[model samples]
Target chain A: MTEPAVTGTGTGTRAAPKLVLDNVVKDFSTRRRKTVRAIDGIDIEVGDGEIVCLVGASGCGKSTLLNIVAGLEQPTSGRVTIDGETIVGPGPDRGMVFQSYSLYPWRTVSENVAFGLECIGMPRKDRAERVQELLGIIGLARFADNHPKELSGGMRQRVAIARALAPEPDILLLDEPFGALDAQTRRAMQEFLLLVWQRTRATILFVTHDIEEAILLATRIYVLSSHPGRIVEEITVPFGANRGPSVLRDPRFLDLRDEIQELLTTQVER
Target chain B: MTDTSLQPVPGSGPRTRSGTGASNLGDDPAAPWRRTAKSGSRGRKQGVLFRLRDEIPLRHRILLAVIGVASIFVFWLLAATLWSSGNVLVPTPLAAWKAFIDYWQSGELSTDLWASLVRVAEGYALSMAVGIVLGVAIGSFRSVEAFWESPIGFLRYIPATALTPLFLLWLGIDETPKIALIIAGTVFYNILMIADVTRAVPRELITASYTLGASRLRVLTRVILPHSLPGIIDVGRINLAAAWLMLVVAELLAAQNGLGYRLVQLQRFHQVDGMFAILLIFAVIGICSDLALRGLRTLVAPWARP
Candidate 1:
């Protein structure tokens, strides 16, 4: 899984990153009026064409952080800026995928993929062309007319991905997009996501509890510690977009995985 | 050298003829009438009645139900003539059937059935129109729910029949009172049921749409409405029976040309057989309406099937 040469984000290139989550903090109030800080002091920068993953255990509020970036939930403090502009609310610039798939059951696969386009009032002929193009990318062209309920869990997620990509967002915020899938499907989805990222080169911030998943997909992995979640470390992966699942067998991958595993246990003990 | 086939595309993506393995099951719902037309004379060879007998429990159940129905008729025939005075109390099944045929021949049955059906159609349509609008509005918005929910919940406890006399006074002895009574009977229940349906729509779907760049109005119209529609249709079918039940009660109060009116008039003249005929007619109408609603549910929302 090696390429002849790489030009972007190598030792040479130092271009401005696409997304900056600067000292983001989020607070939540329980039913009993107890104030709880879900996320504290999270700082992340995602380069253009990069996939960044937030890996944490339960109660670390990785999903909450992802939601804030999506603008579904606002951060209690600090600002999230993309390309030097602060984000106030959800816009077409950032696309999102959820673990639940959340593909509209009433719509067919293509119809669901066309939803974002339809929201922006894209013309019928252009929308149809884009829909066909997306269905092909997801390998669901034959099942274009099939509703979400008729599809398997993996197929549904693929449709969700296509719909998110339809608007061609600058950043994709995925909240455990493959969390609900079985191990086999999750692996396939991870590989498929890499290919999609190579093709689109959109910056992405993904959240997951699985450490191995973060290693497989992310350009850089952010290890989040639990109990008032904060980024423990940022490990820049040496792997490139040319790599696939074959990279899992590499000695470097095992070393990184073990290193992160040790840090996780040690932090949890403290 | 860089792999050329796996090339970068800044504009329109290259057509790689996706090799992604996705199963395709195209629309293939069975249509019986098409087979009949296509087969022509051959259709008789595999007649609808006999062709699927091996697959269906209906053929065997039909004979069992026929025997059960015949036995009831025989018991009625025997019991009605058991004693000289018993005939006055229990009318023979033959006499009831004969009464039906007589009323049908005299055109009285048609007029009564038509009147009741018209009233039900008008009143039921009105309830559905208002109930759906108010239900979706109230269920989706907290402010709307707060304004209307308390009164709707309170009104559901009062039986619509109890308001028949009030409706009669307000509307006089016309079809208006009859229709209004049926509307009053079913509307409140429908409002609550349809509201429950709207509330039941999953919150994840809404958030997903919002993140997909849909506006607030788009979420309501495209997401919430369509997601809750199948359940709303189911609620409507359930409430249609309530509408029919109310029609009978309302007709008993003032309707001069309905089946309920015919039943009352028949009893006044001690025509027990004709009264029994009207009851059987009501049962038949109820069964037909239920079948119709089930068919409509399938046609409108095949995706809702388990």
Candidate 2:
């Protein structure tokens, strides 16, 4: 895909292309010490305020790619850069949401959101204000004191997003944010996420196995190949404004969904 | 044929009921219980008199209580019957209770209890201080972990009682060895328990803390310690019980005055009631301390389930 051309959204200030991954590769050794590659020679760039969704099969290594970008894992070779700096380790600039609602079970929702801020030595008053704001944005204001276990799955995911956004990071890394929710809740969360992104306009790197979700939320989608994830296809989805639940019923969406599915199926069999 | 007008035929047309003295029962003032049955899951509310705990439910609490009480009663009955032969050392429950009151009035029991408690307090305090420090260090440092794992595991399984004679020889028959024995016996378990818990803290949580701009030392203090607190308290509870066991053994080896010393002296003279009185006192202390430790654990870890 060509560089994302900056278009004025009437916000006066456009976000920069904040995160870039160049020819990144990652591998792991099993118990028997045999090496298994996860991400293979994949290059991606996430512009500020852009939503970049990665679509792949089970072993396509999209999740691994996100982890590398998050700095939770080191790439076996190549490099990742954020805001013109070589990424060495995890930092506050890249906030991540795991596939599982990885909210600390022992912490209340508000505390979980404030955790990053607390680590960075934010004063109690400021942390509390930031947490309250995020909670309000996620529509979990009443659940501030509730633990993760008490929350429904979708609610937990909202809290996770709120937590990642609380740090006001330059980029957001999400590993299948709505993968665990039921179909109805998943659709609702997709719309909810879009609203969150529109409000904050933080760069997002979302990994998912669902083609429909990729089409719904992503400004651009990257299709990954199976086994040592390689970029097989990349496309720009030209979704107009006022997209929501009605987008799924659009005839064009079904046709694009089928094409992606057939492509992935053939690649998997091969 | 006799009451045809009142009864009618068996195969008559649909029978119509006269309006009862009441309206729909649900709409009545005292009909809340009727609606409760219709609400859902009626079985859940049955036999609530037995539901003593929110989590344990009625059935489990009832079963546990029955078994515990029956076991105690059965053991006391058997001991009484067997001791009637004058061969067994068991004292009758009444005789033991009488001795307990006598000692309490005379104040001898208070001294013995105090002496034992003081020794346990000193030894356990020392053990806790050293154990937690060493455990955290070894658990976090890979080199230390590798070096201590085998030796610690071996020491954990060895009985503290078996080491009493050796501690007596090394530290002598004074309060020194008695205190030393308790410390030696208890500290190893606490260290291993804390170390195991410290090592089990999730790597992601620590990394998350680091990514949020926390230093390594800060992560250790804030994230690692708080996360491992439940496990630390768990081991602390277990050590409290173990410390008491070691205290008695240490006293038996060498001590002039303690609950253990009094029990042994009374036993030699066949003063079964006196011995029984000391045993009962010991049991009370053991039980109360266990309850206190459990309460502390719950307070420290409000999020943890009992």
Q: What is the lDDT of residue A192 in candidate 2?
A: 96
**Which model scores highest in DockQ?**
1
lDDT of 2 by residue, A155-182 (tens): 9999988877777787888888888889
What tens-digit string does per-residue lDDT give for candidate 2 at B1-306? 223344434333222122332332233445555443332122234354454654565787799899998898689879788767656767777888898898889888888889999999999999988888889878888888889888988887888788888888887888888888788889998898899899998775665565555667877787778878888877887888778888888877678888888888877888888887787787788778778877887787677664
- Model 1 lDDT tens row, B1-306: 123544434222322223321211111235333333321122123434464445546777798789998997788778788832643677877788999999999999899999999999999999999989999988898899999988987888998889988998999999998889989999998888888999998888888888878888888999999888888888888888899889889877777789988988987888988988998898888888888877876777787775
Worst 10 residues of 2 chain A by lDDT: A1-10
lDDT of 1 by residue, A1-270 (tens): 113233465422433678999999999999999999999989988877678889888888999998888888899999899889988777767889989868887778989999999888899999999899878878889999999898999999999998998988888889899999999999999999888877666678899888888888888899989889999998988787678899899898899899889878877887
DockQ of each: 0.44, 0.30
The residue pairs that clash in candidate 1, if any, are none
User: Weakest 10 consecutive residues, lDDT, candidate 1 chain B?
Assistant: B19-28
**Model 2 complex DockQ against the native:** 0.30
Off by over 4 Å in 2: A1-7, A10-16, A240-242, B1-60, B63-67, B137-141
How accurate locally is residue B175 in candidate 2, as Cα lDDT from 0 to 100?
Answer: 88
| lDDT score of residue B104 within candidate 1 | 99
Clashing pairs in 2: none
